[model samples]
Target chain A: MATNIAKIACAVAFAAGVAAPVTAAAKSSTVTAIEERGTLLCSGHNGSYFGFVEVNDKNEWKGLDIDMCRALTTAILGDPDKAQIVPLSWAQRFPALQSGDVDVIIKATGWTMGRDTEVGLQFSLPYFFGGTQFMAHGDLGITEAKELDGGTICVEAGTTIERLAGNYLKTLGIEHTMVSYEKASELRAAYLANRCDAFAAWGPFLAVLRATELEKPDAHIILSDQLSNEPIAAAMRQGDEEFVDMVNWMIAALLIAEEEGVTSANVEEMASNPPNPKIARLLGVDPGMGERLGIRDTWAKEMIAATGNFGEIYDRNLGEGSPYKLERGLNNLWSHGGVLYAPILD
Target chain B: MDAAALKLRRSRRDMLVQTLLVVFVVLVIWVAISTAHTNLTELNMTSGFGFLERATGWSYSFSLIDRSIDDSYSKTLLIGFLNTLFLGLICIVLSTILGFAIGTARDARQLGLNSLATVYIQIFRNLPLILQLVFWYAVLIHMPGPRQAFTMGEVAFLSNRGLMLPGFNVSPTVVLAMFAAVVLLAVVIFRQKSLQPVQKLLLWLVSGSGAMLLLAWIFAPADSSIFSIPAQQGLRFRGGIGVPIELVAMILAITLYGSAYIAEVVRGGLNEVPSGLTEAGKALGLSSRAIWFHVKVPMALRTIMPPLGNQWIFIMKATTLGVAIGFSDLFYIVSTSITQSGQTLELMGLLMLSFLLINYSLAQLVNFMNARLALKGH
Candidate 1:
């Protein structure tokens, strides 16, 4: 009789232990949980991915994606410093967000239909645009990707580029082998060691590597043909419409700030004195914006002040203000001959 | 004093305890699975094995079987399993042979051989397997590329790309038949102790050639050649067997690392053999070589089987480290599958089941071998 009682007690305890987390997760909205926890969790890259996500000499996370994470934290909790960065690999980011280990993935993740539909994740607007391309050793004398037939190409595993490269090469009837590494550093090392004839990755990252990593940048050539043009975005869990809307508008506010010439330096002054109703509404000079989004009206103001507008972030990270010196290309605003256009602020 | 009654009471209690324990386990599993299902439903993610039929748009550096980007996830995973099994089997055979040689060298009279074996064991055993894998990979990739390959008389070529060797262009069925014939013939000859040496030789020669001719007549196509030599193509060797550097490095690292532990096991087993047995063989007018093999090795078998089985299983598990160097073993393929399909629970479950099945088979084989080697009526 005693043993039966003990067994019942153990079974009940085990059931409760398994069921506790599910109930806790279902109880609160992501925003409410962040508010209660007093910290916003955001995903960072596992290693240095130059210009996008990287660590600095001061042991602080500093990159475009890092700034984006901080901006989201500021918008949600009203304090950018409350953002905690959880470094994760490319394959780990989606599961991490789904499991609530991180609130958002701002690690320059590509938006794909399969991921959005099947992976239980939602993506914000395209914050950046890049394409997949191959870079080969100059000694190979390969100028176009088509010339890479019968060559071994290296790629980072668990990335969209791996699929794109594979399909591209196969469609062209090129008989090539592909090797994938788990880490970007390892892939780069393999390429440098000549383990593969070419390396396929994001075009901008290849450019960054050629500029910064190689002893002789001219020793490698980035192929002219591209495998894919991908839209990079911030990803969050699929549920919580309010949280997703907040993130979407937060990005719009940045683009709108850039278009209105409202720098981080002048955001405070502009918020105080309204130049126009649109700017006023965006900076929370008007009252209803934050209330509708379930956040403070001054959320955009705090975020812009913390991380600057979209143009400023891009310039500081990948454009003329940084070592990369990448041209704005399609990332520039629509009025400035680029494709980026923000939804009108009513 | 009612001992049988006490025994009956104890047995009844044992039955009750076991029944209660099983109930508790089932309840725990039900709770855990239901919780996962509820959470998955809440997250709006599908959970099932239906995703295995989807096409995988990825490719790996090497596979024993022909594969393409359009292959199904199941086929790709099977290829991955085959690659792991191939690497594991080769490493097991090579490490056992090398370990036995080194283990015997430790007991050699020559100081140089003994010291060299000791140093080899220490260095490889002390370092982590992962570091050794990376180190060997680095060494392999640093070799000359295909353009400047080290050629061996137009039959084999060694480059950073891999080792390419002459291959037989015969049907697989013919090869399998030939191998089966040889093994069967050897087993038959071993069982027939009454046969003389010349008779055994004649039987082997006649049967081997006869089986080869019969298999070729039945299975070989009209256009097939016996041998295909590797030759330089545009970027790599063509028309031959190509071994990728990742595979070579994996084999090299695992063999060296695994041999160290296995050599120690061998040495321990040999040490456990009583010196009296060796003396008795010597007194019986046996040569030293015969005595060592016939007396020491047989006696050592009982002590060696268990630890050696453990080493084999460890070597099999170590094949997963192939992922670190892009070898596309089962673990790597399943990880890629999870990333692509997002069926983590189902895919990880499959991966665990695969490893369990493979390692369990290896353990069973070892246990069988141990049973055969056990002294009878002990």
Candidate 2:
């Protein structure tokens, strides 16, 4: 009863906070809708997808994709705290975005051709690169994926991993059974219980599960086999070019900052010191681009202070600083032997 | 007011209400269709049933019909429908038997047995079915692998993969002889008025023994084995009947959960029977067993069945929860297809239609049984 009362109180306080900006947001571009409301509505996973999205012990949402929401909110509304994460299932994600229930979705959604063309949503530049990877019990003397011939593979339903595993095994002429669960956590549990011979998921997600969720980390081995590329990106409703452009550039700023050797700790100093013409332009040393994007002169700097550069976000949520300790393999900067690149500020 | 003026006012009011209702219903449908159309167009989505012909591109773990991953979606949905129906029917039968036993036990004179039944109903009824399914699934999956399964002699084995039991491959001659024996026994029993008791007993013993000998003789063939036990081959148990662990867990959880509700229904119906009926049976010189069975049971059944019918429908709906524990039923398969094909509306329509057909058939059966039970003494 106390909890229910507390919940009602919180809801009342939140509604009171939202009332003023909502009337101001009624007639404007979606960007103004976000700015006036002082909140960036983001759709994310209902449960922890490990490093992608999860609510922490402090009752705050945390993860790499969540950091993206923080970045965009800080860039647009100038307040990192002005962001709301709406939990959604895989099937619910697109519908929620289409219904305007959410401003954007940064829930490790794979940018598919079908979704791009058929779904009523627009995707930002790929923020994370992943692929379907297989993990097997270390007790099984299987070193290669081909060794899993005729083995049952556990996977989450309605995911690319299911189709990828099926197609990959079929190409090898290896007949296998696939048991699909609705949630990733359920799939992981089944795998832990020895229900399947191999567990298939995105490489980074599997890494996070093995590193953190497992009691015996070394008991499982993720094979180095890549089944299909899964380029994760953010999605929003179409017909809002200003909102789309703003979202895209927020992603680009992170990459550009990383390229310019600007860390969140050093961004303020870089803005005053004027490291180079490119860095200066990115930091709004000569401010005009902010006006063009309809943001503040120090928008990029504020965004960096709120979250961090792409590398910092990656390291903090998924890499060296996180339990997963995933290396920025294909997600590294373009100049660093990876595919990620930001267009020049010029 | 006079009668003519009052009647005219009443007709006008009735006409106004009828017109308003028709307009309201049409407006609702129009809004619904337009919203769907606008949403689809804005999202750039195509709507049709043509995708059903496309290959499923994934295989299910358990299927009643022979199907490959490359089969059409229609065929996949059919396989899923059959699996759901199979599980639903099995749970209904098992839960009914368990329910009656527990209900009777709850009413038993033995204090210990009554308490035991009470505890079962409390535990299962209070807990949700999904949680029970996951719990049972976890327990099953933690069992030893196929190679090191807990074995029962050479005929049965239990493992994380499934339960394997002995399968019989009887010869045609043995089956025919068994049928002939059944026919002879029926003839002797039906003619009991003409035949002596000794004659009837003698005939039964002869036919039964002849059927047994015939089965033994047929099984003595040196060329083929009649009884096949599952053997561990590679990573799986092969040869005998293999019941997947998921299916077992789903059935166990569903039956246990459903039987609790069924027990309550039965207990309520039985208790509602008048004590006078039992006293009347005693006055008529009926045994206790006969009094309960012939007098009270039939009376309770009329009350028991309607609620039991409701419980049956509940079980049918609960079968969809099998998807949570990786039991591949119709709802699970369609949900998977929706995620893959991005055809949510069409697939959902198909799922609802299939369930509607299934539940309607079940309701019809329940109604038929209820009607028969509603009739009196005959």
Candidate 3:
């Protein structure tokens, strides 16, 4: 009887402890409406590479990934800066979302069944795509990854790249030891220091390292190995279909922006008077579809204004202005013979 | 009341309270453990020590163990423990010597030498451990490759990869000479302790240097071929013993950090001796050294042993940071284990226990020493 009372007392105390924050987050996640204020809690990468989540000299966060986070903010709050970026590591990212640390995860996280079913996080449209590639210092004359029959390869520890590197090496009948590092930065350092004969990292990161590490800047090359698929995209926890729909539609709309020649500079004008009926309807000229998503019809327009159109954001971060200087291969628009497809906004 | 009756009552009351406390603890443990068990189980997480038997199928980038992915988790854990011990032993030995030097130098009355000691401590303390590890791994290890090493008369080869030195070969003559040299060195030291001042100092220096030279010259021809490490080899650098850069850098950092504190402890020990003892030595017509050997060192140890233990424990923890520098110590092995075996919970538990053993055992050892050195029987 006494022990039961003690257990009851402890349960009551624990319940009391979790009561307030749970209530607040519960209110924050109420359906599709705003929680308390005009804000959207978006999570992002603390450190990835280049256009995704590059750190400047002052240690400030800004990149294409930041643009993706801003889009969600503008979608709900009519302002992009309202989104808060909660940069998380690969290990911490899933736990952060499952625990409601943020409303969404817009980091360069890959979509997979194990993560989806196991962690209960739902994937949105792919914001970008990349694959693993083999890179080496140009002087090694190792233009292809297959030539590394008796060489050393470097990869980030505890990542998919380790397994992919192993499988690819096996396929190529190569005999190489995979030197795993805890972080991409360490792997890059080791590769540059010539500790390893070759580097196995994502292609975009290879481009970034090339821009930074190489003397002639073409001193390293990322071979067309395509070791594994990295279908990188945004994610939110399960049981938030309203939030999912809002984010998904906005993505489709952004892809349509590319299809309809909508630049960040031209987005505002396009929103005011989009020529086509579908674009007009999407701009909320005909009838506000925002009513269904519990927002004003001009929500996406607000998102675009805060950042830019999909094409503008892409060009700024991964294109000529950025150090990555990626050539928009698979990430380009449908009209450009790429995989980025957008359904009719109507 | 009678004395026996009073003692019986007290004992009974003590037993009742102890029983109640045990019951209380048991209940608390029950709740916490049940909560963890239920939550983890419901979350489809299995927890057991059975994961130790599973094969950890993966290749290590850098490790102390020749691990196949086929090595069991238990083997991985043991490898991790050994790595920790390797780093710990090296760091502890270096720190003890470095700490003594730094500690003594701190008490040196000279302005420049004292300030240099101060500067050494300050500069190292100011830098973050991780940054230092990176700098060591990158800048220090980036020195010379295997072939491009700097050789000093073929006796010493310093490279970015390692520092190579000629370790003596163990032929019967060489071994016998070294053994004799050690015995003679000890006898000379002990005899010098009791001899007259000027004569003792002269004999100690002469015999020590002479014995060292005699052995060196006697073994010179054998040393030329057998003792001296061959500078040239086809693939692996042969003959010369190679000490890895990772080992050097970790030892250097741990010793540098540990020694500063050891120096401070040493200074405190030196300061603990009353000035009157030295004055008494002068009054009794004794030299300055006699008072120090008897009065100061004994008392200083009482103050020194505790903090020295704490510094060693810090070293044990600091070895974990060796993972950052590619030294496959406890943390590195645990990480590799977790990734390869997928036994996150079991590996985590093992990691915690391994570190706890190292730290707790070190504390126990220090405590034992402190007790031995404590003022005899209160």
True lDDT of residue A340, candidate 1: 79
By DockQ, the best candidate is 1
Query: Cα deviation in Å at residue B119, candidate 2?
Result: 1.4
Looking at model 3 chain A, report the run of 10 residues with the lowest lDDT sum.
A24-33
Question: Which pairs in model 2 have colliding backbones?
Answer: A120-B43
Can you tell me which runs of candidate 3 are displaced by over 4 Å? A1-131, A144-153, A164-179, A193-195, A211-215, A223-346, B1-6, B59-62, B125-128, B134-138, B141-244, B276-295, B339-342, B371-378
lDDT of 3 by residue, B1-378 (tens): 999999999999999999999999999999987997798889987777788887654444444545555577788678778878878877887877787777667767788888988887777767887777777678765675545678898778876545778765444456457668766766767665566767766676777667656665666665364455847442225555556566677777777777776777777777776777767778888765665567767777898889889888988888888667666677987886677656676778788998899899999999999999999877
lDDT of 2 at A104: 93
| Stronger candidate by lDDT (2 vs 3) | 2
What CAPRI class is candidate 1?
Answer: medium
DockQ preference between candidates 2 and 3, better one:
2
Per prediction, fnat is 0.75, 0.65, 0.21
- Supply candidate 1's per-residue lDDT for A228: 73
> Deviation in angstroms for B291 in model 3?
6.3
> Which lDDT values do the candidates have, in the order given?
0.87, 0.85, 0.73
- lDDT, candidate 1, A1-346, per-residue tens: 9999999999999999889756653322778889999999988777788888888666588778888888888988988899898888989988888888999898878899999999888888888888888888989988888898789999999989999999999998999999999888888888999999999987888878886889987788888666777788889888676677778888898999999988899999999897999889988898867887777888889889988999999998887787666567667898997777787788
TM-score of each: 0.69, 0.62, 0.57
